[model samples]
Target chain A: MRELQLSLNQTQKVRLQRALEKLESLSSKANSNASVTVADSIPVNYEDGLLKGHGTSEFNGEVVATVCGIVERVNKLVYVRALRARYKPEVGDIIVGRVIEVAPKRWRVEINYSHDAVLMLSSMNLPDGIQRRRTALDELNMRSIFEENDVICAEVRGFQHDGLHLQARSQKYGKLGRGQLLTVPPYLVKRRKQHFHHLENYGIDLIIGCNGFIWVGEHVQVTDDMVVDQVNKSEQDDAKPDENSISPEDQGKNYTRQETRENICRAANAIRVLSTLGFNITVEVITETVDLSTSINVAIHEMLGSEFYVLVAEKESVRRSMTKKK
Target chain B: MEYVSPEGLRLDGRRPMEMRQIRAEIGVVAKAAGSALFEMGNTKVIAAVYGPREVQNRSQQLNDSALVRCEYTMANFSTGDRMRKPKGDRRSTEISLVIRQTMEACIMTHLMPRSQIDIFVQVLQADGGTRSACINAASLALADAGIPMRDLVTSCSAGYLNSTPLLDLNYIEDSAGGADVTLGILPKLDKVTLLQMDAKLSVETFENVMQLAIEGCKAVATYIREVLLENTKQLEYRRGI
Candidate 1:
């Protein structure tokens, strides 16, 4: 007949009525201590014999939440009584959050999970191109692509000892450039993550978060429409090359894989910027191995090989205008 | 004199001894094992029941029974002044104990020995009669959990103010009362499993107030019993071949 064996057992329940009768005699003597002053909280009779051995106990049968009563936050630290548990985060949860900081090559997203998510520029794949490096010019335009407060789509790339990394490499990811950013209570946001709206149509892409920072925006790219065309085409292909189709040089062991991946990485970040910026141009930066920097002119001219040719022509025109004085 | 002045009326303008409007629904939280929402006047309570899970502590594992636990919390804005923290309070703790104490008498604990059952009640608002509302709400949650119970437990506070005895006391009357009595009853058995009274009253008046409180609880139990019965009927209908 026994179901839950808490403090009020059969004896207790039956005894409660009798206890009340007895307690009546002591009522005048008992004091609620209304005159107590404010102070820090102190634990009172929260733990009975049952919950006392929690940390040391190896048994799974011990009921964790068996407390029936506790002290209130009284004048002086309410003699405390605790039985509740704390909440912790898990993996693969979608949370919405906001951008709080714009760091070099990374954005700090406050996802309300007590931790910031790093949306690194490297997470995004550059548009498909022969140019494998970003020049100085690209760095100047980087902030323009993802400003301090701009929201963006990203995936939980991986968590390292450093922090949680979010990536915008996929077509589904990147600068959620404009929108009314709504901040919701963290818990409500957690509850809403499971029922988030699909952004594919609003051309909206969401970060669906665990920390809560979210990005929503339409697509744009800075590279020429041709490069944008190639990036879109390459992404749509989603092609995984056959191992058999691998080049003989790459097939060999110790093929210096690390350097190639890093080289391609630079190009990838550049593509992320250009493709999102509405550039349809194909890669001309392949010839000169320029690195991305804060300077946009050097970045654009060096990466777009054709741009260098345009620069040369413009320089010759300037020279003719200067020598015509002779 | 009225428990509430005849001219002043109860906060909602009901006569003394009148219970506040109670709106209850079950199975509201999708993720909880069992959930129910009970709104007594404006004292809204949400309860979730989880149980029969493996008990993890070594010493608490009794060779013979499941454990019952209850946590009662009021949301910060539920009252006139905001509460900085939500959990771990004395009045809340006392209320929690009573809820646990009352529920233990009804649940069939032997069915799952060495296990535990948890009842978490969150008060979203307060006007008065919080304990009874929590009890009523927890009962629905337990029932929604498909747990076995001896009977539904309903609680309500009855008090005496001025000369009139009130059946359900709101915050104002309760604070201003000469005596406040809260009782939880097992309606079918006409048993009082949990009872607490503050302040004082004469013997005859105390008896009358207790009777009125029990009667109010019985009425609430009857209404909630019907709700559980209808719910079971619907569930059975869904599973019918």
Candidate 2:
């Protein structure tokens, strides 16, 4: 079995075991027999005209699971939901990716999918927020917009003949900077109404990519001021020669503050702890973890320590049990 | 050398039909999409599966099906001789081919078009039946990685030694210049995906040995199913609703 590789003291080990057992008991009452392994047949009523979905197949007049996972039934359709698999993209889901190649008119993005997604130059709103056909000059300057290895956030636009396509047409979706990117198993992240969260208290922007790539960074306001600023900077350059000298200093001034950086690390560490414990990562759970660490006065790095892991497990168990009672 | 004693016990004190202790663990490699450590007696193998992701080589990408690749390696200390074998030796390459073909027969490659799945298995200890152990490990890793397969492929080796068909030989009996039959089977499908034998045996005796190997494979399949079920349960319960 996959186990957490941790060195825990005697009491901590017992506590972790107790918490896990509690979690098991709480969930087992709901759907204890829903999980199935490969080649195991799912008991379905053939008379009802069942439809087999992904991770399931017909074998010798029986519906058998093709993967190791839980069997889900939605009315007449039955399918197996695989855990710990790669990100399976769905249209309209928000995702974070890394630019692997700046192609002629499209940027090849790695979104932890079977194939790299194509983000066309025409699909995304230009940095200037203008709506026009991408010109040859824009194709040549694609690297300046999103060069190789630059992290990007976009929405799944659907599949095309070439491959999966993504678009960033809104101000909320675009280049992500000043952040730490984390990857957990894609199954941990469910499709929720909101994937982008701006923690006003910590001044951190958390973009929970459906593809399992998470970005925690200093918040950048979503506004058209950057475009106006660019336009004014050009005019300033033509009007005054000395403004050019201060431009480089302006680039240096974009650095994040020390306090905000610490908060980002703290939030990132909380996520790491949650993913390691195999907990479902939601905005509420993440903030609760961060709050737990702060309330206990644990150092940012200590959030990854074994004690914190045990504590989180206990807290999650308590949270689930309480929710179950209602 | 008499591998089977008059009392019908083999050198390892196992009966002619008795197989070695088989143990399997999943997710040993944290970074791998799917990984497993499988052991049969003194033989131990670790396998990791990556991808069903982007195909690395553009020329090798298949339009209608996913490309499957495998690599087999043995640690320097895996063998008793402790010789440092060169990478991709002839033996390892042949075993890698055998494992790849065996796994390809069961995986539903057609479902994952234009992608590639890579299986890497390394022998940590070699007693006998390392090939079979590697195949079993690869199957577990593939299933653990949540790759779609028609059925779990399990393999076992049986040997004809000293006028007896022994199930799961060890290193000493393996080098006895006897007939060793390595069999891979899809238990649920009741199909044999791989069958290889070395050193000639009578046709009638070969059937008995192959049957014994099939039995061993079924035993392995049962154990693997239990392990996989337990793993699935743990993951589901831990990630509560």
Candidate 3:
């Protein structure tokens, strides 16, 4: 019932409930009592010299949880992993965020964190691919690079005194366009080795941000030739006044084919259904969902219908069971 | 009027020490970080918590702790009279301050510095003891948001009518011109965060009424803990390993 606000018929409701119950049963029984609410004492062997970590505090000489979460213990360290909380950034996390403000020499991005992350202009590679000091001219043209409200993919640079800082030095980490942005609870997104995925068959790109901002868009290859061409084009413009404001390459990239657009929507809808069903989202599951929808001939929009939600829930239960068997 | 029958039953057919039926639902507001709807008999309240995020006002940002803000409102149709009331009236503002102070005391604000947390509670049905209902709803919402807190806070109201101390006073009993006491406490820590009393009562009678309210709070706390634990288990199982 939490965020599963679907209008399902009686039969569909019964099916969904059954699927969810199966999922519950499939979960490991070892940690059934591991879940603790606020102020609940986390039983531990105090004689072992345990160190209290986040989401825990001392109360009456006993370790009490300060948040509602699962108790996690690692050797001498004891902590609680909170669910449904805001994104807690760690170094080297790939995140997608929207530019909230174009501050002086930096762009404040709303990355679903406690504070807007700061993406300094110096941290990112300029459009021209030059490795030189940032001049005043670069500051004036900051909007051209990342305008306000632009969705960008960057890495979490270590936090400074000001706040959390981000860097986008790689070509793959930059502004994203012609796509849909979906926001889910940060806890649902597990950090993995690969966050970026390019589905060759669908010709679409999927970015699973650690901060829970997902990007589903037309695939754009990150090649050095495009950077060289941009540098040459800028030189040409300086020598002779440009006849057309928009370049042919820019136009081609901006115009997404109908098939690719549909693929983007399909992938985005798949994520929406999975997140609502509270399933752990991964590339394998997303692709499987997409394949399931297409094989069944469900329209892109219908992927969000009540019937599909039930199907996905059932499919996930079956898939999880199969994995357990392995 | 005979508020309590000689047989010890109140008008609503409940004993003087018995509380109304309490119900709670989490994640009622889909958009909020944390939300809950709490009901105490006929009094219903919805609470939504947003934040532990960037402080909206730069000047108000705290260097060593998070700023907690609260707003309390009553729907025009919440009461029986259906009177249109202006926003931020004197009574509402006072109640807001009281709720904010009570919540701030339990929330571990120092853990989230330079951020602001906003708690919004609205009364859908104002039967009686709206203040206590709002406090309880806000506490649930905060816990749902995963905000760090020293302990879960629960509140309840008690009033003296016909020399009998009643728990969880309803609208009729609340307006009976008798002494009404609203108590908020961190049930796990066993510390009082808020206590408000209107009208006058003798020392002995005040103690009796306060004792009844404390017992009511402990009962509410047990129910809240059960709700939270159930919700946590649901979320955990759904997001299986």
Please state the i-RMS of candidate 2.
Answer: 0.8
lDDT of 3 by residue, B1-241 (tens): 8899999999999999999999999999988999999999999999999999888889998999999999999999999999998997999999999999999999999999999999999999999999999999999999999999999999999999999999999999999888899999998899999999999999999999999999999999999999999898889989996
Model 2: how far residue A313 lies from native, Å: 0.4
Q: What lDDT score belongs to each candidate, Candidate 1 first?
A: 0.56, 0.94, 0.93
lDDT, residue A132, model 3: 90
Candidate 2 at A217: error in angstroms? 0.3
Model 3 fnat?
0.79
| Shift in Å, residue A96, candidate 2 | 0.4
Lowest summed-lDDT stretch of 10 residues in model 1 chain B? B232-241
Write out the backbone clash pairs for model 3.
none
Q: Write the per-residue lDDT of candidate 2 for residues A182-236, one digit (tens) a residue.
A: 9988889999999999999899999999989999999988888556778766866
Q: lDDT by residue for model 1 over B1-241, one digit each (tens)?
A: 2445658466568877678877788667745656789887878999998765545565786557778889998888889997687467688888889899999987768655666788999889888888989999998788666554556678999998877788888888778857999998877556888888998789999999999998898788767755654443322211110
lDDT of 2 by residue, B1-241 (tens): 7899999999999999999999999999988899999999999999999999899999999999999999999999999888988997899999999999999999999999999999999999999999999999999999999999999999999999999999998899899999999999999999999999999998999999999999999999999999999999889888996
Give the distance in Å from residue A262's predicted Cα in candidate 3 to where it truly belongs: 0.5
User: Top model by DockQ, which number?
Assistant: 2
Candidate 1 wrong stretches, greater than 4 Å: A1-326, B1-3, B6-11
